[model samples]
Target: MNKQKYWLPVLGIFVALIGCITINTPIKAADTIHENYVQKIKAKKELVMGTSPDFPPYEFVKNIHGKSTVVGLDVEVGQEIASDLGVKLVVERMDFDSLLVALETGKVDMVISGMNNTPQRAKSVSFSKNYYQSGQDLLIRQADIHRYHNYRSLSNRTIGAQTGSIQYSLVKQQAKKAKLKGMDKDNDLILALQTHKIDALAVDTATAKAFIQNTNGLIRIPSGFKTSSAGSAVAFPKGANSLVQVANQSITKIRKNDLINKVYLPKVSKYMTNHKSKKDRQKANSMWAYKDFFLAGIGYTLMISALSVCLGLLLGIFLSLMRLSKNSWAKKIAGAYIEFVRGTPLMVQLLFIYFGLGIVVNIPALLSGIIAVSLNSAAYVAEVIRSGINSINVGQKEAARSLGMSRQLTMRYVIFPQAIQNIWPALGNEFISLIKESSIVSVIGVKDLIYQSRLVQADTYRGVMPLVITMILYFIITFSLSRSMKYFERKMGHSND
Candidate 1:
């Protein structure tokens, strides 16, 4: 018997085993079932629907007499669907893109926002019957209103769209000649449109109509914006066959009976009338999309500030010592740390420390945020302190040394005190800024003052109220501290500005 022939059979067996293992390990994730989907909605008595509220006409929270109600078309339709199914409706409002993520993450049973049906989306989620049809329209400033002739007219022109939506994909593919800036959400692109950061924006016609209601100085260009069957539907992840069947039947029955049209659809169309009123439109514009989500934002901001300031001071002091150190290793290492923090993004550092580094160190979430903020802040503080130290002149240290004092004693006794005195005002301003920058922390899940405000927004859906409160809170916190420091820095002058 040949040994090679015997080895070939053995090699085939090994290959077969590896192939089996690869298939069994799961190349893709199975769609997540809605959390507690089968646990009986009748028993739970609450049916949760996911939506992005910022898209008006489909779904939005309007400040009606100073109260926020879920009253848009999608909201009405969701309520009707819940009623028909004999379950109470519960809406969990979130960012537009997060709605589908929530639905697939099993946080929501269904999503009925004005979601479009596409094969790509269908691969991830199942769609129910279409409720409404809309088309992509271009939003442009009054200055460029006549520039668009058709979607082709958009070719070679700069366009902006929300990052994740099918609109983004469409414009990217069809308008290859078009310069497109994809932003985080619809609101960002809308702001860019107003600011003229981008020449135009491609969005759904209904959304364009809604934007006209809220904004001035912009009109939709007529010719190139062709209508498409942008059908609105209820969607669940694929593999949710039972849920899909239930939803399609529910939507079909609701559409056929005119309940979807009569009750749900009208709730949004009326807002088109109010768009003409300057006072009402301004009030509407005042309502921010993130208003409901601003609860922890205040605390997060301040925390970032406090942590950054505090950490910056401590670490800055240590680095300053190294900057003055005689040892080459100490100076090089300190230089490296300072350069790293100063060169990179403070936001990325904040995230890395929170999500990545802290996992291994086991620090409390608050402390981790503080530490990251501090690390970044300290680099700047180090430079500030070094500048202050250098400003004191070498004469003071030489004078102290001539008085029979050591180098360490000269710095401690003669130089540092005066350096601090001169830099006090500059340091105070930096500390105040740290508090303002802390607002970024709310997204990282730290429940500070801003975080509390987000909760208020979530409940009230009143954007300005919580934001006003957060601003007032921060202003009070920072202003009081600065004023109190005047007694210490006796020569310090206050600036009204």
Candidate 2:
């Protein structure tokens, strides 16, 4: 009695310790520690730069004569800032909206995404010197250019901008002001303009030129646009003053060297080809990454998803049987695994095993993703097995037991085969879910269909073609699975009849 009491308190303390450790650990939230982190970059000797590639003439990664290179004013300025501070540049590329989040996380040393310092972001990150400011404008076809008399001419016209850009913000404000239809995303913009889905677009002159060059048959209307009073600057997390001073001085150094004209201009301007008009170059950026390429990705997704579901089914049946066993510890272990996997977000689970596990253990990324997906799938699968086993009229198990059949013999010879045929269609549904969810694996570079489509879009800067192809591929794979499931369902029914 005394020993059991003593160990109970020790076990309680151990449990409390684990809870405290988990609670104290940092999560995906922004890095407030460096919120005032301006001083850290200067002292750290390692500068992390965050930029969104959609902004051109400012920050963009271009495929120059076959080699991909980051070019534009922001790149030129960011490199100088790192060199001046006696630190090396570690540039991080992400979506426009995510750039600020990176800064908020302190994952970035500074953000130079042609970002205008707004009061919202100011709460989290500090600002350095303003290098350049830009105003929004429109570039449209000459024949159709006259339609824009003012912001009102843009009304009812479809407009496009990269999500999270000041350009998008300005367009959204103008769309409300003039009652225009505005869409977010540079890719969406190119598609709208090329397909005549939008009458005109409202964006900056520089971004307009780059997008127009990226696609054919689209022009920027020279009239009917709003302006951006906002100015672009280097962003540091709040409370970082010393880093601000160092970065500001670096900008002053680079501007004087004429780096803007010499290096940045020629590199980006190479993509600025002369085109006749949008109609004449209709197929300009129309095709990329063969339709069959995504078909292969779809095939890969289906393959992994099918294998994972098969693995989950077997694991689920075994775990459920163990949960029904006489051993309390075995039941507890199975229950905990199911609860833990189901309680967490699938995305976090994928990242935890694929990326986080990489730090302590090394494994192929695809297998990591498979394990994450399988863990989550197994939880639901446990319930499915329990229900399937239950649906088999209890009299069947009773009669078998009465016939002198052992428990294991009855389960193997009688229960499983019928339960599987009955639940076969539901298993098909699980497989479909796994395939759709496989898109999350792309975050760890599995090169699944969705990731490949995005890479093609970024490289070519064409929005419509890659996505259109991807959709078709997904449809083909899912439709094929549905047909196969129904075929099996009918076969099962025929056997029963």
Candidate 3:
């Protein structure tokens, strides 16, 4: 009877505690679940906006006081939004196609590029009210303006549009009779049109006008295609209702004040006009004027390559040792990793590291690029190392063991040195490849040669010259690296002799 009384009270207390938790837990969770996207921004005191700087008038690089700054209509919109939210605006430059991904991955709080709210994109992200509505236009060579009047006029000719853009889909769906060519950047499409590769380049009215004004030998025409109301809006991650609300308020204020039409557009036009003046245009178009851009690009490219090579070498050694180990698990793991990394494309890997992994932890773009490059280089270097080690006669290891050297000592003192000597040339080739391939990091806005060249192209509106300069710079870097590698190979050869 006494035991029953004690146990009954204890059981009752336990039940009471459980009931309390069940009742209060949901309330606490609900409280915590209150949307705080705006709060987070306020706490951080900065609104990070992602954009592609190549699209002039919307977002483009400008050389102000010897500093390359991202300035345009989209930037002004982002600034307005940030100002309303009581935070500073921070811009993250990336490829236009990458802007949405960056927003989805939390790399940026919102994407304010010239992004239109389409049914397809709306499904993936929440967009604020339309800030700017622009009509579609076709840019053609000055001489071909009469040749192409509208989308229908280019029936059999090739029309170029930016890949992943609304214009790209517009051309595909409406101008079905025309051959559709897609490039990543509008500048490239303009170059294609100038070179006669594409007859017309479909772009926004503002972008087409900006290009025609700044770029020589290009003229704009109306793209008379039936389309729904398409307007640029700020994009936020899905279910970011709080952010969308604030962005809408800011956009509403902007429209109410006629800021976009009267202020922003005029300012953007002034920037474009300043670049188009005869003296300034001549100065800006000169390759020598962009020496700093190229030099900066080379510096960043070398930094990334050098760091990646060193880190990859260390990681490759570890992975190679693991693959060559006696333990089955280690060998299997190392083998699987090498195979997986080697099998995938480097661009995919770079995106994965930057955006995919970014969800778990925020990583800066440059660091992400270096990490991706190093991990990729490790896989290739691992293979080269394994081959070098395997090619060394079994006699060397056996002889080292006979001399009372432990297995680890044999690898450290005898096996590795000879393997490195044998692998020097292969390693040199890998190093050279690293230098060339590091250019891919520019896609993430790493400020490498390619990214800098794109900035120069945007700033100068002279696409081919920047490309030519970049190509020459890359050649110089690689040729120097190759010669240095050869000199080292010769020295190593002498040592072996």
Report the number of the highest-TM-score candidate.
Answer: 3
Q: How many clashes does the backbone of model 2 have?
A: 16
10 residues in a row with least lDDT, candidate 3: 1-10
lDDT at 386, model 2: 67
lDDT of 3 by residue, 10-121 (tens): 4554475456435533443344332898999999999999998888899999877666899999999999999999999999888888888787667899998898889999
TM-score of 1: 0.60
- Structural similarity to truth (TM-score) of each candidate: 0.60, 0.68, 0.91
lDDT string for model 1 (262-332, tens) is 86556566744556666755555453633434433544565567657776898898998888789866766
What TM-score does model 3 achieve against the real structure? 0.91
CA lDDT, candidate 3, residue 478: 83
How many pairs of residues collide in model 1? 26
lDDT (Cα, 0-100) at 283 in candidate 1: 53
Best-matching candidate per lDDT: 3
